[model samples]
Target: MYLVGLTGGIASGKSTVSSMLRELGCPIVDADVVARKVVEPRTLAHSRIVFHFGHEILLENGEIDRQKLGRIVFADAEKRKLLNSITHPEIHKEMLKQIIYYFLRGFRYIVLDVPLLFETRKLTHFLNHTVVVYCDPATQLSRLMLRDALTQEEAEQRLAAQMPLNEKRGLASHVIENSASREDTHRQVLRLHTKLEDSMDFLLVRVLAVAATAGLGGVLLYAAKMIFS
Candidate 1:
């Protein structure tokens, strides 16, 4: 199985790439979705967070007030670290479980879409290849402002919180430049899909060749033993 790690800064079009991969039949394990699931009401993460940050972060309906928690944590490094400490492990565990499920089900290629691939540095061990979707700072700011309704400064602050786009591009095994139209991005994704499929075919051939060679060697050894006997 081939595991690809997909990462990019906020509003950098990673979601679009993920969607394209899904449409193309690649199984995806989304970290953000897993993160939310891990912190759902009545979960251990939810309980730990409530205990540490007080009940004020909970709504009257007994669910987490994500906005309130975001306000408290995003602006404070310590609080953000505390939140990550509570959530990251659970998220990682769930992601790994999903990855293993897909792998065992015979998926040749799977994409692990994560926002903080570089920051967490867990991609190195889990991913066979890493793809980073990237755009210029101006394009990122514009898209983020329109999508999230944030001011330029606010968007920039959020962008700054993660690694720079250039750095992510440098670290990635493949970079999808998304500073163009949706059609352009789709073309890039399709190209990437082709490349990944070709690589998978090559890997499969190599594995089959090795197995065949081993089997032939074993058969020859058995024949030699019979003759000697």
Candidate 2:
């Protein structure tokens, strides 16, 4: 299977690209979605996070107060590392499971939509190609402030939490500049999808799918524990 990793900075429209791909029927394995799942109220990751950050990061009804936790981690380097240590492993494991499932289902390609693909240095290991959705810093900053209802300083802090967009552009095998209109962005995605379809390798994909099957039983037990505790 061809594994394509997609990422971009905070308000940079990476998610918009993922949605466009979904609209085109691409199988998308999203780390952000799974990351939220692994931290659901009773999960091990959630428990660890609460323990690390304290009860102050929880709501009155016991669910995590994500905004509160974000405030804590984004500003502190050690806390951010600690948070990544707790969450990234489970996210990667789930990501691999989803990829294997899509491969076995005979898909030639799948999108691994991970916001932190570059931050976590995961591109080299997990992807056949990497796509970075980019916009200029001014666009990013303004969009973030408007969308998240943050001030300029607050938006800058969130932006600082990740690598610069321009630097990530350099790391990418493909860059989708989202600074233009949505129509332009859609055209870029369609062009990229066509290129990926042209590059599929059947024999290699089947071999990898077979190899991945061996780990399924192991992660099921691990997943059970994660869900139960």
What TM-score would each prediction reach against the true structure? 0.85, 0.89
TM-score for candidate 1, residues paired by index: 0.85
Q: What is the lDDT of residue 221 in candidate 2?
A: 48
Query: What is the Cα-based lDDT of residue 60 in candidate 2?
Result: 94
Q: lDDT, candidate 2, residue 76?
A: 96
**Per-residue lDDT over 29-111 for candidate 2, one digit per residue giving the tens place of the 0 to 100 score:** 99889988889899999999988889989999888888888888989999999999999887877777786688668787899
Query: Candidate 1: which pairs clash?
Result: none
Tens digit of lDDT per residue, candidate 1, span 1-229?
Answer: 6678899999999999899999999999999889889898989999999999999998898888887887678678898889989998888778777865885587778898999999978556646789999999999999999998878877777777788999999999999999989999999999999888878443753474466587765764454344222
C-alpha lDDT of all candidate models, in order: 0.84, 0.86
**Cα deviation of 8 in candidate 1 (Å)?**
0.2
Task: Evaluate model 1: give its lDDT.
Answer: 0.84
Candidate whose lDDT is highest: 2
